[model samples]
Target: MPAFQSTFDALIQSWKLRLQDAEAHETKLPARMETCIRVCEESLLELRQWVMEHSFPCRECEIYFFKQVKPVIKARYIYYQKIHRLHTGYFNGSGLLEKERLEKELRELAQYFTDNDQFFSYYRNGYTHHDELFFVRGQYDWKICPEVNHFDDLFSTSFDGKLAELMAYELLMKYVDGMLNPSCKLTEPATVTPSRSVAVSRLQCTASVTDIVELGYALHAKGFFNDGKASIRDVMTFLSTMLQKDLHYYSRLFFQIQERKSNVTKYLDELKAGLTRYIDQLDEQDQLK
Candidate 1:
């Protein structure tokens, strides 16, 4: 689940009751949504502190291994934080432009992670809106599971047997598995050079905006996920840099993937056609000016 908290106390209690009365779960209430988060947070804090204090490593009979894996573990912490934040936002509000803005961020983040949509920005979007509804195309175990006989029964049942799990959840779980096992594969990241050469030779002005963005994503996704440097200082640096930058040029050249049609590839096509027509008409008007 792309949920911020791994398990809420209410969620856990719900699971317990689900095992007790699977059908009556709709009526089974939780203390509060935050209960689970608070529990998860305290548990994780203890666990991380233990790891840090004892330096426990899953592999290698040495504490040195924990040092190497510390980054990965820390990432899970951040992932949980993001999940909680979005979970709160959904119940509360993320402001007016947050959804669209975060959607764009997630799509771009997907490029870096190369379709690892679970931790991607849009994953946050889903958590913050529509009660964090995620849409999945396939029956991936982690992303989509259907509620069936019982939540407890799922451990014994094959993934195919469950229908209550959301498809998005299953897929997102697959992404998480990829993070863990890395047999978990994602697409390669890509980029658009914004040069005329590729436009003329490859895309031929007919390439769709989705195609261009996909290409860029494919290029960029090949790289590793960069969850570092996102602290307050880094955020301040980014904002300061952004304030000095040109949004119009960047928006036209890059940052408009949400619409798919605002990509430079689309702009080039319209501009080319319009310029050709304008030049032709201007030549006819040469009779006057």
Candidate 2:
């Protein structure tokens, strides 16, 4: 029981971290999503193993499954739904009209989770409380059921573990795509021209913590960060404003600058110079104010 409790705690922690990463707009969310689902699957499998090893009674095992495993899976599905809504709201008025098609795609992706939620509720209610003899009407006897069955067999088939796995995988893929590239318009061809273009590839480049700090410092110098210390939220807000305003125009120039510099140090130097010049101008304006 102690070991099972520990595993369940770890699973909850993993889910929390996964959602935290999503909230922070971390580039590695897809990876974290995989880890999150893997932890749930593993813990559930471990519970099954323990039940078999101890030869626990069917009712006890079912109670354990209901109390422990179901919560993790249910939470994951809810997280997916929340993220989908966040994506939709975040990009709703991004001014990239072409991205409306992608918005439609996102809605479709969200529907998948809605469907899964319905399926989960139906099976969970029946399997958890009723013990295979559901009160609900007229559902065909599940082919996997027998005249009588153990909790393990009932859960193994009715829980539909494979379906859950596939749903998680699909949700992760679409969620990652939507989160990381919300500004993207899939209907248009990706721009190859280096002149003042926002390449789809550039959207994939995530800002590291260090990058955020440096950018924040520059903005602070330009009088954007009123406090001496820049918080993560401030950095994110500045970046979002930049994307919505100036970056859209100069993104191609930035990309061209990156392409021209082969040496890492030179690249950093040139990038810093460009940012510094812009920051100085903003500082001058602030001083005049």
lDDT of 2 by residue, 3-28 (tens): 54564576557656755665466455
RMSD vs true structure, all candidates: 20.3, 19.5
CA displacement after TM-score superposition, residue 286 of candidate 2 (Å): 62
Q: Per the 3 Å backbone cut-off, how many clashing residue pairs does candidate 2 have?
A: 1
For candidate 2, report its TM-score: 0.32
Model 1, residue 230: distance off in Å is 33
lDDT of 1 by residue, 1-289 (tens): 2132232334435443533452243342232323433444554454445435653232222212222222223333344444445434544253322445444444444443433334333332433331112221121344344333222221222221222122323333333323322232233435546684456355323445444433334333443224331222222223234233212111122334544554545544665788999999999899777
Worst 10 residues of 1 by lDDT: 130-139
TM-score of each: 0.25, 0.32
How many clashes does each candidate structure show, in the order listed? 35, 1
